[model samples]
Target: MNKMYKVLATASILALAAMPVAANAQQLPAQAVQKGNANKQTDVKNVPATWGQITNFVHDKSDKFITVTGRGLAPTDQDEIVLAITPKTKFIDAKGKTVPLQKIIDGHKTVKAFYSPNITKSIPARGTALTLVVQDQSFSAIDGKVTEVRDGRILVKGTDVYDKHDEEIWLHFADKATIIDQNRKTIAAGDIKEGMSVRAFYGPAVAMSLPPQSGTNYVIVNTNMEDVNPGEVNELTAGTAGVITDQKDGQITVIGQPLEKGGVNYVVLSIDDKTQIVDEDGNKLTKDALKTSGHVEATYGAVMTLMYPAHTHADKIVVKKAESVKIEGTVMPSDRTSKDQVYVNVGSDDSTANDVILNISKETTIIPALGGDTALRAGTKIVAFHSPVMTKSLPGITSAEVVIVTSDKDAVQPK
Candidate 1:
């Protein structure tokens, strides 16, 4: 029975190789199939040839093999063919250049393999590879901001031609991967930083994972921040000041007052080696300084995910000092003792309610919700950063350091 099965399998492989182009037209590239057939006729001389995408490659000290699927065959595990590589196997690249085996495996390019006619009856038949030709060596480009940089890898968040949505991809740099700056000068991988704009060139083969993984070939850093006009928003700039709600897994969750009436109120800031974490006194600190319920001002890249509580790569994070506290609530009607004084209700429930009066002095920084200076009024939502110490009066009062108007209903247009 085994001998009969081998004969049948051999006959099936031969018939499929000789079959018309229409049978495997979609699976194999036209140029690859034509060249494969020509090689069978001239070089191999009656040896059967099969072409497909390299699904798996195994290379050790002296053992090397590749699994492929195509040539009128289904892509199922049972239909894959394992081709063993030996010293006699010739490797040819897309440009007809004679290349090494490592180059073909590194690119993970689709290939046409000429093999011996004798076949085994194993689930996935095995054979000796004669000549392998790389079908495509075309490179793909990804333009985005670097979110993370690790040992020999960098995570980029951006879009490609095939995917319009935001994609976070981890690019594994090949040993020979070239890194260059804007002037085209070669640089080390250490120069790549979080929030920096870069374009990476990689191969088509991608490993299936949550965030897809690919082998990168070349990288170009776009480092020209001085050219941007002051106050102009671009792909390289984004800022938010809010309270830290969570800090874990190298990310900080900041819950700030909404930018507009119904805008986003939270942002996830991803930190990397280049992210500067400091205190308001200009003293440098580690990421551990970002504690929950603490106020912070973060500057990150404009490239961010569109999901709720958007995520971005942070460039700098300024942690508010321990002496300060942030209060967020609705403004309440109260008779002010002076023009710089305002009152706010500090809690939703009656049991926790506290009427706090904020003294906005000339030294206070008032930022309006809609981008310009606007006076705070009743029923307005505000986030005020002030000293924790307050006067022990009916309505607790303190000097406001920074008051952000978060409501638009009472916001007046700036002149």
Candidate 2:
């Protein structure tokens, strides 16, 4: 099979920030400690607010001075504030139960932290945390395909998320487990079925098995086939690629890539207020933003509605990249002087063209089909989905999104 490339990134326009130096969260700077004291002008009546997803956390047992990054606590989103916790500080879970401070200090925990403002400290000084409210636990959400579902168990498969490789996990539900849909309606244990889309929030507990197993607690469902009788509905699955053809009010029409011989061209999508939309990178987007020119890949139910153009409700819609293009040839060594970079030969058997050099930064995603990028060698049949827009400088003329390695002499896209 030939290699296939699918670029996930658009033009880069990210900002730069100042390099950081570490500090203690417990024993904040003298200026911070002073301002936090009521005698030094600290006011609780008009305390500043900061709230956002907790990106990082530090728990210092030795120094007793815990120092860590602050989330958005101000009225507006603010990630610049510093927070320190002491024995006097309090921690609470979703149920308002007092959770250990040691439990709160972890990466990616959404929290609202209030700190003592008006600090007399120098630039970017750590502030004393007046009160911290944890909105969620240190739980991670798993979005994937449910391969199996039983009374108390469910099996799902998806990318590792962190490592970007296919992985499978099993979830077991407790008798009193809490499970809800997008509308906050509680779902019955029997309602969840195989081949449905699920966004499972797992953590707080899991069996220490190879792939590990946990409770089927909270979930977001895209479709439910149990709504219809057999032979009355068609089927749709996850990762199916399509393009938004029309959208009005809340109804959406998509042109799915043909799947069967003499297949239908258009699909009618029922969009509710709860249906989620996002770009290829999983960033949330609005319904109006789904353009006719923009392609999409979605996860819906197998029970397709019997409409003029088969219909179904999309659980999740990931906009397919408009900037994606195919490139095939050999892997060329990078000679440019830069941190992360790679070059590729875009020539084919028909004609050998000029080598297209690509500059790879930490932001550039290199999805390998086989061995890692370092294994890419000269004369290797390579295929990549890269951006058509060329960079203004050297190192790389164009950047890549997804790169696949072809075996032997096959340049045809592999199934």
Which candidate achieves the best TM-score against the true structure?
1
lDDT of 1 at 96: 65
Give the TM-score of each candidate: 0.32, 0.28
Candidate 2 residue 243 C-alpha distance from true site, Å: 20
Error of 2 at 48 (Å): 17
Cα-based lDDT at residue 322, candidate 1: 52
- Candidate 2 CA-lDDT value: 0.50
Candidate 1 lDDT over residue span 181-292, tens digit each: 7666778888888888886755445544546666674676866533355556533455767667668999987755432212234578889889988989889999778887
- TM-score between model 1 and native: 0.32
**Candidate 2: residue 244 lDDT (0-100):** 57
Per model, state how many residue pairs clash.
Answer: 0, 23
Compared to the true structure, candidate 2 yields what TM-score? 0.28
